[model samples]
Each structure stands twice: as structure tokens, then as C-alpha cells.
Target: MSEHGVDSNQIRELGRQALGDAHLQEAYRSSTLRLYTHRLAAVSEVPGFERLRERARELKREVMDHLDFYLAQFAENVERRGGIVHWAESAEEARSIVGEIARRAGASEVVKAKTMVSEEIELNPALEKAGIRPFETDLGEFILQLSGERPAHIVAPAIHMTRHDVSDLFVHNLHSQPTEVPEQLTAIARRALREKFASAGMGLSGANFAVAETGTVVVIENEGNIRFCTTAPRVHVALIGIEKLIPRLADLAVFLRLLGRSGTGQKLTVYTSLLTGPRRPGEDGPEEMHVVLIDNGRIATLADEKMREALYCIRCGACLNTCPVYRKIGGHAYGWVYSGPIGALVTPQLTGIQNARELPFASSLCGACRDVCPVKINIPDLLLHLRSEAQERAPAPTPSGAALGERTTIRLWAWAMKRPWAYSLGSRLARWGQRLLARGGWIRKIPMYPASGWTDGRDLPALARKTFRERWTEIEKQ
Candidate 1:
């Protein structure tokens, strides 16, 4: 297997592992179902849901098309409001910029909100390398942090872990008594994170939208921990993607309506704070505010006219909840910061397609993602585009021995398909030859053929006596 390509064997192994774990299966299935049910109810109550989605799409398109102008304008306004803006073309640059900020602040500890971009750049490890301990404020993120695990879902990061699992983790890690109660678990996390919020020298977060009109960055969260991270710390750093821009503050209202409803079934998130810059005069907020605009492969993404719709994603994870494939194997199988439908579409692009070739093929192309996306991104179309790109960029090598023989047999079958007489003769030969392998009307195995691997798990259907074309011709004559 190519180093860039995801190993097919690894995918199968992870899938089989997930399927065998009854607890993990239940955790993913129930959580995703709940979110799906909530989203349906919330979206149904809105009168113009589709129109709202289109409006959101339009706003994003406008911002994306004029990205440079808005980005500059947004930076100028932020500077005017006593904040600093940094531009990072790559993940290394972003990390260095953030590390400098933390080091300058003499920070020993940093508090962070739930930010996918931070995950994308692997920020926590960098901060640790800089001798600054970073604490995850979001409940799900905190759980993953404690357990040393990656996020299994986009919105609900620890959706794969059950309450019992969490309880055991806490008991083992935090030295707390085992308790499966959700509220107690939340309290345990809140208590542990509260000290980090107060003692940390800086806070780091990701913005949902960066409005060019007022140079305001908007963050929406239900936990209220984000509120503390943005305000409690002396220095606050917001890492934003170049694509997360809007022309005006007024446009934010349209997205606010869709984000919460589509994500967790609320009219709006519990805490929606707009921070223009650092604290002013007597107002209580961070003393220093910095916005780092990251363009880690987003410029290339924007260049692709066919896949640009992916830039409109708002990180809602609604598509994940609605996807059947995501519900089964779960997010860990995708082997990246993101998972599910959005992951399948964007990961190969964000990471090199060569490194993530299997990501595109991970999808079933069911179109549920397109149905639930608030911005109405054509996820299926993008998946197909990436699948084709994967095949073109990284074709599978021909195997030697029995596998090579199977390849030769398939090629011969294709040749026979082009000629009518050969195809008829081939069908008759297959019927007679398959009888040798068939047992109880099924092919148990085929020695020296790659078909055995497939038949190892499930029986192959027995071949028919006559081809469909032959039967159809006879019926026509009658």
C-alpha cells in the first residue's frame, strides 16, 4: 500500500472492531438518533427553512468570492478596535504564531474552547511542547483530553464513549469515585476546568463567523465555558479560518437561525458572544486580543470550482447525525480530526488526497448530508469528485500470484462482454464451471481466486442456468 493511501485492511479492522463492541454501537446509534430527531423537529417548526438555507449559502458565497477584500477589511477594523491580526498560510506558521503569544504572556497554562481548527493543527500538542498546559473547556473535549482519545464526532466529540466509560475514566484519572450520573459527570468536569480558567494566562478559541462590517468575531456554545475562556483569561486568541468571513453583521442573524436548529434543535445557542477586540477602559474582558486567520489548504479548496461548496460548512455536524454510515463504523475509522460526511468530503482536500485516498470512498453517497446541510453544500457531488480524484491520483497496484490471476480473469470477462457470441459462450461455461464450486446452491469457495476472501464471510449466490438476455429473447419469440 502507498504511504499516502489509507490501508483497506485497517479500515476493515476498525469497522469490525466497532461492530463487535455493543456499548460503542449503542452510544453512537442513540446519540446520533437523538440529534437527528431534534433537528427534524426544530427545522420543521421553521416556516422558510429551505429559503433560510439558500440565504446562508448566498452569504457564504459572497464572503468567499471577495475573501481577500473582506479579510483585509476585517483585520483593519480589528486593529482599530485595539486587537492584532496575524496571517498564517500553513499549520506550522499558525502554531508558531500562537506559541509566541503564549510565551510572551508567560503563560504556564492555557484554556481552550471546542475548536475544530485547533484540532486540525494539533494545537494541544504544540502548547505542551511550549511548556504550556492547555485544558479543554468543552465537556466532550475535556473527556477526550482526559482519556487521550481523538474526537469521534464533529459536534459531540466523545459520542462513542458511554456514561460508564466516562465514569470509569474519571475514576481512574481524576481519582473520583465511579458514578454514571450525567449531571455529576458534568459537575466533575466543570469543577476541574474552573481552576484552569482562573489560573490560565491565556485563552484560545475558534470563531464561527468573522464579520467584516464591525470586525467582530462570533462564537456560539451551549456550555457557557466558552464565555469564560474568552473573558476570564488575560489574553484571548481566536484562531479563525480564512473562509469564516461574512460581508456584514446583519448576515449573521440568518446563520444564527440555522446553526442552532440544525445542530442540536434550539432556536439559538445558549451563549452567542461578539467580541470586537480586547477589553476597553473599564469594561471587563481580555487585556489582549489576537485573531489568527489560517489558510491551511483552504486557498486550494477555494480554487476548486467544483469542490468550493465545501467551504460553506458551518461545523454543525447535522449531516453526521443523519448519515447511516457514520452511525455504524463511527468517526474514529476516518482517522482524522473530522469524521462522517463532511470529513469524507473535506479531509482529502485539507490533507493531501494521496494521504487520504480512502476517505472519499468511505461514503455511501446516500445524499443525507446534502439534505441536512444548512448551507446546502452538494456533499454527494463533492464526494464523487474526490473519489474520481483519488482513483486518478492513486491507482491500486496489480497484485501478484492468485490476485494477479483474478485480475486476469476479470479482464477476460470484460473482453467477452464486448462480443455477443463470446458473452453467451462465457455464460454457459461459467454455469458449468461454477457447479464444481457450488454447495447447497452457493459458491463456498474458489481456490486460487481472490473470490475466497469475499466468500469467507458470506456465501456467493449460485449462477443462473441461463442469462437474462437469453430468457428475454425466448419470451419475445413466444
Candidate 2:
């Protein structure tokens, strides 16, 4: 079992449960369809969208190639601007560093913007263990915080919840009146988080992009709460993954354009704050600024040549919105903080293939994710790579009767495929055998072995009455 006690090996069972729930199906279908549609409309407006994607991919490749140089330069610039940079090689170290920073600041409570890295490290529990309360200020995050559920989507964390769900949760937790109006719900959350923003001694966030040229941390959001989380408190902290670094400030423009359009279908987000360092003279921001550069398995991922392309992901959630498998199973079913095609690659690599062996096999290889990706990560290719690795690392199969039967079946099939006479005879046998199972030109159910598994969820087309070889022979006669 992993740290979260959710086994990625149980993905098949979890996926089955997700498939059975009508409400979850509706929530995922509607939310992903909306985002996917918005992205299409947004991309159509930009004639140079493909060029932008290529440029972004090249920039990311350059940064990954010379990551050591950029990290040093970024750290030097950050310290030059009076910002403290802390390095953490593991999740435990990262959490300890954040807890110590809060303690040094004498903070009893901290306000946090929605940062997936923080969730990745399980920072909230660490803070609470050290006798500090951490408040989530993002509307979706706040709703999940009160309801005690993990985020269901990357951009829209509360995408699984309906307006009625939010209204009911607010009534029970916030002691507010029940109303299905979206504006009323937003007002209620805003009113509640304002107190946390005012009283909290420290604010925390995750950097969307860290400019190595000037040591600037760039954060974008549709809600204004992140601005408060970074500026209103006496001390500010940003937890950044090591892969979040970009080489130059000029490179930011291409990514900013891609991220917004790919994420929410907006040309640009509402608030894009660029914080260089601590508050300057007469500035209205935190007195102290800290940026924690966290590795936590990323360095290991960077070491692999073929797998390094996974690092190019910008977390726009476009892949999730466009993935056929993710549209059905949702985020929680992935059994980790990250979800969808990107998650399938990252989770196994970060958590170990033994822990998440089933994740790589969860995709349909439909190429929608790769098509929609802003950075153009070849998700299908990477998935196949991981699948091969998982099989290699998997334990030796037990020689049970069923297992032996499967192996024998595969060998026989291979032999028949290599011989024309055997292949033709086998097809004739299959056609006659399938007659018992076929109904209305489709095989709705199969009573044996691997064929039963296919029929459980979907129907298979029945074999044609005449073979293609026979049709070709008739044409030759003519």
C-alpha cells in the first residue's frame, strides 16, 4: 500500500465502481465535455496554435537538458532579491521544511492557495500534526476541505460536485442558508475565507512557472484568492516542483498563451501575479518570501532518456479532458493526486511500478490525449514503455491450470497465423463456433476465458459468412 492507503493495483475494482455510479458518470461526462469543447473553440481563434505548441515543447526540452545550470541561476537570482530558497529531495524533507518555516514564523494558522504539489506531499496533515491549522482558500478547495474529499479534477477541483451538493455542504458545514444559486455559494465561500486571509500569519502557494532568468515565481488563477494567499500574510511560501523551471522570462509568453487556452479556453486567466522576492520598501506583500525547490522523485525521472518527455507536462489538464478512459473513471479512481494519461505515467514512475502496475494499462491508446496536449507529450508511446517495464518487473506467473491454458492458447494462435491452411481452417471453425453466441450479427456474450472478459462490457461483431480470400478469388475468376 502507498502512503495514501489507496492501492493503484486496485484500479480495476475502483474503475468498476466508478462505472456503476450514474451520478459520477454524468458529472465526469458533462465536466470533461465542457472543458474539451471550450479548448476547441479557444484553439480555433489562434491560427498559430501548432507553432506555439512546438515552441513550448522545444523550450521545455532545452530546460530539461540544462536543468542543473538553470536551477543554480534561478537560486542565485532568488537569493539576490532577498528570497530564501530551500531544497528538498524527498516528500518528508519538503513537509518538514514547510513545517519548520511555519514554526519559525510563529504561525498558528496558514492560508493556502490550491497547490497540487502541497497535496502531493500531504502538507495539510503535517501542518495539523505540528499544531497548526491550514485553511484552503480556493472555492473548489474550500468545498472539498469542508466535505473531506480529495480534488476530482486538476483545474476544477470540485468538478464532481453539483450546485445542490455545494449548497447542502455549505448548510451543514458553514451553517449558511441553502440556496442553489452559484453567486450565493461563491459569496458565502468568499466571506468565510476572508477571515482566514486576514488572520493567518503565513500564506502558501504553488508556482505555475518559475523564471530562471529573474527568479520570479508566476502564478495564474481565475479567482483572486491566490493574490491574497501570497501577499496578505506576513510570510509567504511557494512550493515548486523542480521541473517547473523555464530558462528565460521571454519563454513565458508562449506557455502563458498555451496554458490558458488549453486549460479553461480563456485567452488569459483573470489574475497573473509575478512575485520576484520579498516585499520591497512601501510594498503591500509578505515581509519574508521562501521558495522550496522540491525534487521528490523528479530527479530520478529526469535520469531516464525515454521517460524524460513526461516532464514536459504543464498541468493544463487538457489530456484529462480529452482522454476517453479518464472521462469514464474520473480522478479518484486513478488512486492518486494526479489523474488521466499523464498520471498513468507519473504515478508509476514516482510511486514505483510495483505499487501502480495497473495504471499504465488503463488507457485506450486513442491518441486524443497526445493531440490535445499543449506540450505534445507522446502519452501513448510512454504508456507502452511503462507497460513493458511493468511486465518485466512483475513476479513470475503461478503455473495454474487456467494460466497454462492461456499460454497454450497463445502459442497455438501464433502457429496458426503463420500457416495459410491452418489459418483458413481456424477461421471456419471460429465462424461455426460463434454461431451459438451470435445474436443479430453481434456476439453479446462469450462463455469462456478471455473472450468472456471482452463480452462483459461490450459486444463483438460476428465473423463474415464469406472470407476476404473467397471474395478475391471470385473477382479473379471474373
Candidate 3:
């Protein structure tokens, strides 16, 4: 959001300050764990899980290969349905288009259905500049918009706020009372949003998937707020990334299966609606319907053969829920609209090779993300590829004293690695050094800089008294 890639460093500095505040951490952990656990349970219920994943992967591959054809067909279909389709080549154009729509319509208030693409384009700021209020109708998004913060989780935006925080925000900002209870908080929000929904002139939402054959946009959500946004406003606008287009109405079943099971672990979201066009003739719908299909660096990503699968993501947040680093540090640490393993690979790729170069290296390369991605996006492989691309494109960082020290250490290790006995000896000696420095089977402190962060939440594993080579010989005697 800040500068693009590691565009998150400024964000990280801010989020670290927030994470230190106990209330934020408590709120983040509780909500994330609950969503993560629920998703796992739901995925387990579906038989032939791997087979479902395979189908999704194949379908996505097919769509990615024929992206241009599908985009043309989809645009034609939307036009046929009497809906205007706008093509935005950049984030700036996309923002201007939406703003112009709202301005031309003479709309003062806009209700939103939790769109990440809008966030990516900073649409709220643009709408506000036009003297119009943009309201996030989804519950989590509403909480975040109220908190004056960005979403920490992809699917769960207010995952960083605890019950008490929400209560405080409602009472302090909305000029109301205080209570930590869920039902009461929900009631307060519902009452407030209900008033806004009825009066808003325009509703904006992100399409979960756009059907190529029918020119239909599908939105999946737990709250009825999305439905509210679609019907309550006189004008409706949906912002979608180009890759969200899938070929047919039938393909929806494949993604729908994988989407909920992998993201939130439900059989289906609370509401899955297909919106074709503005109230069709006599139907009760918005007076005008417009779909702005955004390219916004997607075409650049499409050009790369290796990274194209990154576009197939449905924003399920499953990979985030399962990431070891994400689970501990959380999404804010990634410092962007999209986070977790998917963010690490795709953000740098989309933003540029030079800007967010550090992100691809942030992963431990755990395959959890690829395993859990219902669409089977091979995240680890993509991360490695991005790492190579980032290195090839960027001017290597000017090494500080600590980085020089690390380079020297690596050079020494390389020298040893060239000789088998020396390499073995160095590894053996290193394990001894670790044991000597450790206290109670964990490194209590490291006399270093970045390594200190690793020790923050975990203990170093205890070394085996004997090396694997030693143990192997002993086992061989049997």
C-alpha cells in the first residue's frame, strides 16, 4: 500500500507498535484461531479433498490460458445484459472511474460490500475527496473502517480487534454506551448500518468470481450486508480483478467448493448471490449496474509463465490461516492489503521486482500454503522464483556491518561446504556451540540482530548429543 513491495516496512513499524499493545494481539489471536479452526473442520468434511483440489487447479489453468478470450467474451456478455463494463489499466484509472461514477450519479453516501480490490486502489480516500462518505457494510470491514486501520486478515479484516476494542470504538466514536458482549455489539452495529443502507445512493462491492459465459458476477459472504449493498442502493458498482473471470456458470461449483472449504471451512458462505445486471426490466435491483474489470499489474503477472497461477487465488485466506509466520506475527506484518504466503509471492511480483524484494525471502518455505490452497497454487515454488527474480532485478542492498558479518560467515560456510570432511566438522562444531550457548534447551539470547526476532516466540530445539553420522554408524552395526 505504501510503496508497493516491502511497501510494508512503514506499515510493519506501525503494526509492531500496535502488536505491543496487549488488546490488539488478544483480539487478533482469538478471531484468527477461530476462523482457522473452523476452516480445517469444514475441509475435513468433504470426501476426496485432494481430487477437488486437482479439479480446481485444472480449471484455473484453463482459465489463465484463455484469459484474453474470456475477458472479451465476459465484457460482451455484460454489455448484452445492459450493464456497462469499464476497463482500468492502472489503479489510478480504476479509482477515477469509480469516483466519476459516484459524482455523476450525485451520490453523497456509498455503502460497500468488503472489496479488497477497492482497498488496493485506495478507493475510499478518492471517494472521500469527492465529498462522499464510503461505508464498509461487512461487519469486519465496518469494525476496521471505524478503527481507522487497514485489514489485518484477508477474509477477516478486524481480526486484530478484540471484543473490548470494538465496544470502545462503538461507544467512543458512535456516541453510545459500553459493553464487551457480542450480541450487544452486533446489535449496535446492525442498527447503525441499517440506517445507512436504506439511505445510501450507491453501493460498491467486489465480485468473488465473474462468470464468463453469462456476464454474471458472484459474491460470497457470511453477512447479508453484501445483499443489502446490491439491492438497497439506486446504483451498484462492482470492482473486479481480471483473473476473477471463470468460463461458465458451471465452473462456479468447482471454485465454490474449494473456496469455503479452504478459506473458512464452511459448506457454503451464508449468502451466495449471482447478479446479472441492473434490475432486469421490472426486477427489483439497482437502477444502474457497472463492472470495472481492473488490470492493475495483472497483465504483467500474466506475462510471466511461472507466476501466472498466483492470479487464480479467490482471497480465501486459507494460506494465511495455516502459515507459521503469519499465525504468530499475523497479517499486518506483511504490510499490505493481501498477506500471508500468497502475499509474499504475489505482492512483489505485482508491485515490481525492486520495491518489495525482501518479501519472497520472508518465507520458511513450508508447503502448508500449497497443500491447503484449494486451487493448488504452488506457493513455495513461486516464492523461490520470485526470490530469484527480485535478486536479479534489484541493486543488492549496501551491506551494513552486521550484514557484512553475515556474508563473511556465509563465505566461510561455503569454503567448508566445498570440502566434505570440513563441512561435516563445521556442522558438528556448530551444534556443540549451540548447546554451549543454550540455556535449558533454548537460546535465551543471541548476540546478533535479525536472529533475535526468531527467538521472540520460540525456543531453539535441543541438539542431539550425537550427530546423525554418529547415530547412523551405530544403527549400521545392527
lDDT top scorer: 2
lDDT of 3 at 50: 85
Each model's lDDT comes to 0.89, 0.91, 0.83
TM for candidate 2 is 0.93
Model 3 poorest 10 in a row by lDDT: 3-12
Off by over 4 Å in 1: 1-9, 397-402, 405-418, 446-454
Q: If scored against the real structure, what TM-score would every candidate get? A: 0.93, 0.93, 0.88
Q: Candidate 1 has which clashing residue pairs, if any?
A: none
The candidate with the higher lDDT, 1 or 3, is 1
lDDT per residue for candidate 1 within 170-289, as digits (tens), equals 999988878999999999998898889999999999999999989999999999999999999999999999888988999998999999999999899899999999999999999999
Query: How many backbone clashes does every candidate have?
Result: 0, 0, 3
Q: Write the per-residue lDDT of candidate 2 for residues 1-478, one digit (tens) a residue.
A: 4655546777878898999999889989998999999999999999999999999999999989999999999999999999999999998999999999999999999999999899888899899999999999999999989988777778888888889889999999999999999999999999998889999999999999999999999999998999999999999999999999999999999999999999999999999999999999987999999999999889988998989999998999999999999899888888887888999999888888887878998988999999989999999999999988887795324323233454467679899999999999999999999899898899998766577777878999999989899699889899
As for candidate 3, its clashing pairs are 5-356, 6-356, 39-265
Q: Candidate 2: lDDT over CA atoms? A: 0.91
